[model samples]
Target: MDEKNHIITSPVMGTFYRSSAPGKAALVEEGQAITPSDIVCMIESMKIFTELRCEHPGIVKRFLVENEDPVMKNQALIEIEIH
Candidate 1:
């Protein structure tokens, strides 16, 4: 099974921030290798920060959402090519 189809998705409804905090570098960028425990981004909801992690290790292929974009529950955030 390929990992490309396994895409990283959002957890809950909130605003998706590329970085952990505002004005900081993004959590991961294109071509970056991310592990299951690695944080890809953070979703802020009700004033709570939620870390979004990958389900497997892979190289980032695309960012489905732009910085400071609103994301819905279970939305596709990024696509990773499973290695």
Candidate 2:
């Protein structure tokens, strides 16, 4: 059977951060396994930081945005292939 891929999206408009802080490793990297409760990234809006989680267990396929990139609500952030 073909592998099913899922797209993880942003829930709010904000600045997308791949790492917790500058000069740090990203929370999730491409091809990394992730769980539903995993904190994949963070979105900062209005001076508040919000942790974004993966809704399904899968392997991260690709990142749609770069670190510190501005993102809009509902924008695709990452592609995950379901396990």
How many residue pairs clash per model? 0, 0
Scored by Cα lDDT, where does model 2 land? 0.88
Q: Which ten residues in a row have the lowest lDDT in candidate 2?
A: 1-10
Ten-residue stretch with the least lDDT total in model 1:
1-10
User: In model 2, how large is the Cα lDDT of residue 21?
Assistant: 85
Among these predictions, the greatest lDDT belongs to 2
Candidate 1 off by > 4 Å? 1-3
Query: What digit string (tens of lDDT, one per residue) describes model 1 on residues 5-48?
Result: 55777788999998987789888999988789889889998899
Model 2, range 1-83, lDDT digits (tens) per residue? 14598877888899999988889989999999999888899999888899988777999889989999999999999888998
Return the lDDT, model 1, position 38: 87
State the lDDT at 5 in candidate 2.
80
